[model samples]
Target: MKEKWRLLITEKNSAYRNMAMDRAELVSISKGNTPPTVRFFTWKPRAISIGYFQSLEDEVNLDACKNLGVDYVRRITGGGAVFHDKELTYSIVIPESHSQVSKNIMESYGRICGAIIKGLKQLEIDSSYIPINDIIADGKKISGNAQTRKAKTVLQHGTILMDVDVEEMFSLLLVPNEKIRDKMISDVKQRVTSIKHILGKDISFNQIADAMRIGFEEEFNIELNKGILTDEEIELTNKFEKEFFSTKEWNHRR
Candidate 1:
C-alpha cells in the first residue's frame, strides 16, 4: 500500500499563482520529485477560472471582471467556467499507477469525488455524486470538479461552495443571450446550492477542511501528513506564472 499523502493548506493567492502551482505540483509528482499531494486553498480578491478549451470572450465578461477587481485565469483542465468566490478549492495529484487513481475519467471522478460526498455527509449534508464531475445535495449542485491527465499524473481540482452569489456570478460570467439572463440566473439559483444554504448557517473554512481531511483519510485509507510545497514546485510555479498563467496568450488562447 502507498504511504501517507502530502497535504497542504495554502494561504490565499492570486488566480495565476494558484493555477500555476497546480500544474507545477503535477509536474513534480510526474517526475517522482514529490509525493501524491492534496492541497486546499482560496483565492485572493476573488476570481473566475475557465477551462482550457473555453472561449474567454464567449464565456466571461472581461470588462466586468476587470472593473470589479475580480481576477480571471484559464485552467489547464477542461470544463466550464466557474466563479471562485466564497469557496474552498482542493487539488489532488497522484500518479496513474496508484491504486486509488483510476485509468478511466468517469471512474476516477467517482472515486475522487467520493471523498467530497463523504465529507459533506459528515456535515449532515446528504449528497451524492452526479456522474462526469459534480456533487449534489437535495438534487442541487454543491460542488463541481475538473480533471486533466499529463505525464502519467492526474490533477483533479474542484470547488466546495461556501456560499453562492448568483447575481455577482452572473455579472462576471456571460449568459447565452442578454435577453435570457434573468431566466438563466433563476434556473441556476434553483439548481445550485452551498454549505451555508444546506446547513442554514455559516461554516468556517477550517471546519470544512477538517471534515474533508477526515473524509479523504477514511475513504482512501491514506493518512494525509501536513506538508508544504517543495523547492522544485515553487520554482516551477514561479516560472510558469510569469510565462503562462500571467500572460494573455495562455488565458485567451481560444
Candidate 2:
C-alpha cells in the first residue's frame, strides 16, 4: 500500500483567499491537525502577488491594478511579483522532517520541481527545472515557484502558466519609464512561455490538474486521496485573509 496524502482541487478565488489557504494548510499540517496536502487553485478577476520581502509600492502599480480591477496581495513565500491570470497555481504542505524532504533548500526545490517537470511531460511538453526555482520549456520559463519553511513544515507554491499576456502583465507592474517599459515587455515576451504556446492549443484546467495529480503521486510514491479542507482550516483561512493577506499593513510591509 502507498502512503496516502490529501489533495485539494479548489475553485478560483481572490489573491487574498488563495494566499490565506496556502498558509492555513501550512499551519494545519504543522499542528498535526491535517495530513500533508497538495492543493491546486487559480485566481478570480486576476491578481498580482508580491514576495514577502518585496515592497508593494515598488513592485506593483496600484493605480493600474485598481483600474484593471486586479486584486493584489503579499505572499508569505519569497519570490518576485507574479501576475496571476490564466495559470494553475499549486501548493504543497509537508513536514520538514518528512523522509523525502531535504534540509538543504536547493535540493528540496529540485525534488519538488521534479514532480512539476513530470506533470508537464504528461501534457507532452518537454521541460526542465532551472536552479533556484523556475521551470523552463524550450528555453522559456513556463513555471515559477517559491518556498518557505516554518514551524517545522514546508510550504511551496508556484504558478504553471496556461496562457500569458505580457502587455497586460506589464500594465499592472511598475516600470521606470515608457522606453524602459516597452523594452522590458519585449524582453519578458522572449523569456516567458505557457501551455498554449507550447502545445499550440488550449488545454482545460481539469486536464492539467489531473496530470499534475499523477505527476506528484509518481514522484513522491504516494496516493493522493481527494479531500476537502477541515473546519479548522476554514476558520484559519478566514482569519489569515482578514488579518494578513487582505490587509494593507501586511501587503505594504517591506
Candidate 3:
C-alpha cells in the first residue's frame, strides 16, 4: 500500500528559479492542484540561502558574498545558513491530505530523516537521525533539512553534501567576531562530514539522487512517478519568479 508520487527534476536552475518553483509547487499541492513532487536542483553560479526569519545584515556577509559572486536568496523555510556547493538539493511537496503528511514539525522531520538514514545506508554509511533536523553518520551531520507548512500543504527541503569547502562556508556566513567564526569552523568540523569525505571517494550526484528516491519511496510506501513539472507548475513558477523569489525585500526580511 504505497502512496504514489510525481517528480520534478531540475538539474541546474538559477537560485531565483529554483526558489520560485518550490513556492509554486507548494501552492499547487496545497490546493490539491498538483501531485506530490520531489525535485532535485542545483543553483547555477552557486549561492547562499538565508532562512526566512534571518536578518540579512546580521546573518550574512553580503559584501563577501558579492565579492565572491555568490547569489543570495531567503528560503520560505526556517533553518541556519548553508553553503550550497557540491551538494544535491531536494524539495518535497506533499498535499496536506496525504496520510503520510505531518502537521507537527518533529514528526515530519523524523520521517524525512528516516528516509535520509535509509538512503545513506545504501552507501554503507550507517547513518541515523538527529533531533531538530539532521541526518548524521558517526555523530557527524551529512544532511540538514527545513520545512514550511501553510494552508494545508508541506514543503520540505534540504542539502546533502557531496563535498564541502569548509573555509568558504565559514567565510560567507556572518559571525560576530573572528573567535566565533573559528569556533564555528571547529564546530562544523566536529559535527559535519560530507559523504565523499567519509567514503574517501566521490559519489556521483545521480547515485545520491537515487538513494533519496528509494529511501522516500520505501518510507512512504509510494510508487513514485518519475517526471518533471507540469505546464501549470511552469506557468505559476514564471509568475513567482517575477513576484517573489528574486526580490531584494524578500531576501532581507527578518
Candidate 4:
C-alpha cells in the first residue's frame, strides 16, 4: 500500500487569500494536524507576487496594477517577482524531515521539480529542470518554482503557464529604464513559453491539474487522495490573510 497524501483543488482567490492558504497549510502540516498536502490554485483578478526579500514598490508598478484592477502581494518564499495570470499554481506541504525531501536545498529543488517535469510530460511537452528552480521546454522556460522551509515543514509552490502574455506582464513590472523596456520584453518573449505556445492550442486548467496530479503521484510514489482543507486550516488562513498577507506592513516590509 502507498502512503496517502491530501490534494486540494481550491477555488481561485485573491493573492492575499492564496498566500495565506499556502502558509496555513504549511503551519498545519508542521503541527501534524493534517496530512502532507498538494494544492492546485489560481489567482483571481490576476496578481503580482514578489519574493519575500523584494521591495514591493521597486518590483511592481502599483499604479498599473490598481488601474487594471489587479492584485499584488508579497510571498513568504524567496524568488523573483511573478505575474500570476493564465497559469496553474501548485504547492506542496510536507515535513522537512520526510525521507523524500533532501537536506541540501539544491538537491531538494531538483527532487521536487522532477515532479513538475513529469507533469509537463503528461501534457506531451518535453521539459527539463534547470538548476536553482526553473523548468524549460524546447529551450524556453515553462515553469518557475520557489521554496521555503519553516517550522520543520517544506512548502514549495510554482507556476506552470497555460498561456502567457509577455506584453501585459511587462506593463505591470518595473523596468530599469523606459528605453530598455521593449528590449526586455522581447528578450522575455524569446525565453518564456506556455502550453498553448508549445501545443499550438490552449489547454484548460483542469486538464493541466489532472496531469500534474498524476505527475506528483508518480514521482513521489504515493497516492494523492483528493481532499479539502480542515476547519483549522480555514481558520488559520483567515487569520493569516487578515494579519499578514493582506497587510501593508507585511507586503511592504522590505
**Residue pairs in candidate 1 whose N, alpha carbon or C atoms collide under 3 angstroms:** none
The better candidate by TM-score, 1 or 4, is 4
User: What is the lDDT for 14 in model 1?
Assistant: 94
Off by over 4 Å in 3: none
lDDT by residue for model 2 over 17-100, one digit each (tens)?
A: 999999999999999989889999999979999999988999899999999999999999999999999999999999999998
What TM-score do all the candidates reach, one by one?
0.98, 0.98, 0.96, 0.99
Lowest lDDT 10-mer window, candidate 2? 174-183
Q: Write the per-residue lDDT of candidate 1 for residues 147-214, one digit (tens) a residue.
A: 99999999999999999999999999998899999999999999999999988999988999988988
User: In every candidate, how many clashes are there?
Assistant: 0, 0, 1, 0
Report the candidate with higher TM-score, 3 versus 4.
4
Q: What are the C-alpha RMSDs, in order, of all predicted structures?
A: 1.0, 0.8, 1.3, 0.6
Could you give candidate 4's per-residue lDDT for residues 67-108 as a string of tens digits?
999999999999999999999999999999999899888898
lDDT, candidates in the order shown: 0.93, 0.94, 0.84, 0.94
**lDDT for model 1, on a 0 to 1 scale?**
0.93
Candidate 1 versus truth, CA RMSD in Å, comes to 1.0
Candidate 2 regions exceeding 4 Å error are none
Candidate 2: global Cα-lDDT? Answer: 0.94
